[model samples]
Target: MNSLKLPDIAAQKLLHVTPLDWVGMCAIALPIQLEGRHVAAMADAGVNLVDGKSRGIHMSRLYLALEQLEHQALTPLAIHQLLADFLASHEGLSTAAHLRLSFEHLLKRPALVSPLAGWKSYQVSVDARLENEMFHVELSVRVPYSSTCPCSAALARQLIQRQFEADFSGEVLNRESVLAWLGSSQGIVATPHSQRSQASVQLRLRNNLDTVPVTELIDAVEASLGTAVQTAVKRADEQAFALANGQNLMFCEDAARRIHQALRELDIATAFTLRVEHAESLHAHDAVASSQWQW
Candidate 1:
């Protein structure tokens, strides 16, 4: 019997073909270890086929190279190594390499004024590109919060004031009776409408950092917003949350500015872009605001 030879279409050079800007694969399903937990992650791996004479790249090499993610933490150094492997596998055919890994990061969050806690998930993405020996990494995270409209709150207070005056048109107001009425439903007729909102932040980080600062970024976002959505709550916790929301009432634009200033004051992120979305209860569409800072 004769030995069989496998066909290598990827190695065959085709003349006069235009080189592709990006080549390889996307949405490849894989399971990876993130900070010790096994997380299912989708990977998009690719390299630029810079050599016009090369017909194609070894796509399997890119796929196999992603296995490194499953074994190690997704850090800047790890990503750099992965990108290097991507180009090394393609050798003379590639000049630049890129990788995007997206996954949900889950954390246990305690409720306000409660002993209980539960898990909350945040959408996270890491985008890496190695071009011309300059490696760049960008991280994106989405955090859900509660946004209260300042205008609506003021309008509601006005309506409540008008009702109070009508109730005591000529009657002398007293601390005792006034407190009674205030405790009654007539004193609290309406409340400002609020809804769930999201803050989407993208940060461009400097190299030489060892680990991914995922938890730190999430903490910064929550602290800036001041009214992050709760996971588990008792009645007291719910009341505390309401009080926090009342104290930190903000519109979409307000949320964006808060995030921008908070991030700048921290001075951790090299460059950042923040966007806030308030899923308004008063409108059919969401209200959005964006801000960016770069040096």
Candidate 2:
């Protein structure tokens, strides 16, 4: 039996009509390579057409085009080019295109000794848009750290001191005796709660460039706060972590201020957003603060 031939849709378009304002898919998960590192990323691609009288769009074509981008480098420059190509493929249907990709960026870091280390993951997002022959890209990251409650620490110190005095009444207090008393339950009436904290920074790039170093950003954040959460730790590392936390006791406001100051020192533009959230262990609610560059 002979198969009947069908007419091509691209060639049979006889009706002239306005295109759609926005068309495409979202949350497209795929593997991507960045800086020679393979990572799983999700991409949201869409186009805005001059909508007037079109029944629908060729969604499969968009997905096929994105499939080509898979396994390829996803730098800022490459993303700009990809969006341009996507818009070109749509031809008269759209004059603008937008794409958003998000992924978990993993970095291997050493703990505070014990010869053991592991990877720490962060949430990264990249957004790009093309309009009027121009492209814009924005990069964002969420970094986690540790924040100690300064208020709680001060109160705990007072309570412990008071309890120590009461427990050692009528006994000659010496440095060793005081130390022993403090180590017992009678000395530490209360201990402050320092919770795990996270901060998000979103920066709008001036040009299509991948100059922003992810490692540098992570280092700056960890250094500015003087303490970071550990992925792998031993008994020695735990003790070292406690010491570090004691030295870097900070409030939520202090955490935000530290990040804000660090970002200002960077070469990035004065316009950016910094948000910090501290999940309080003492209370059911979290402490959050935000600071944005005015320029």
* Candidate 1 residue lDDT tens string, 144-250: 99988999999999989998989989998889989998899989888999999999999987776777787888999899989999999999999999899999999
lDDT of each: 0.89, 0.80
Write candidate 2's Cα lDDT for 1-295 as tens digits: 7698875564344366755667889988878777777778888889886644554556666777776656567666777778888878877677888888888888898989789999999889888899888887777899998888988999999998787667877887689987777678867889888899999988766564555356667777888998888989999999999889999998878888998899888775436788899998988999999988863
Best by lDDT: 1
**TM-scores of all predicted structures:** 0.95, 0.86
Where does candidate 2 stray beyond 4 Å? 1-21, 67-72, 169-171, 268-270
Q: What does the lDDT come to for candidate 1?
A: 0.89
Candidate 2 yields a Cα-based lDDT of: 0.80
With a 3 Å backbone cut-off (N, CA, C), the pairs that clash in candidate 1 are: none
What lDDT does candidate 1 reach at residue 143? 93
- Could you tell me which 10 consecutive residues in candidate 1 have the lowest summed lDDT? 261-270
Report lDDT (Cα) of residue 149, candidate 2.
91
| TM-score of candidate 2 against the unseen true structure | 0.86
Clashing residue pairs in candidate 2 (N, C-alpha, C atoms within 3 angstroms):
19-50, 19-51, 20-49
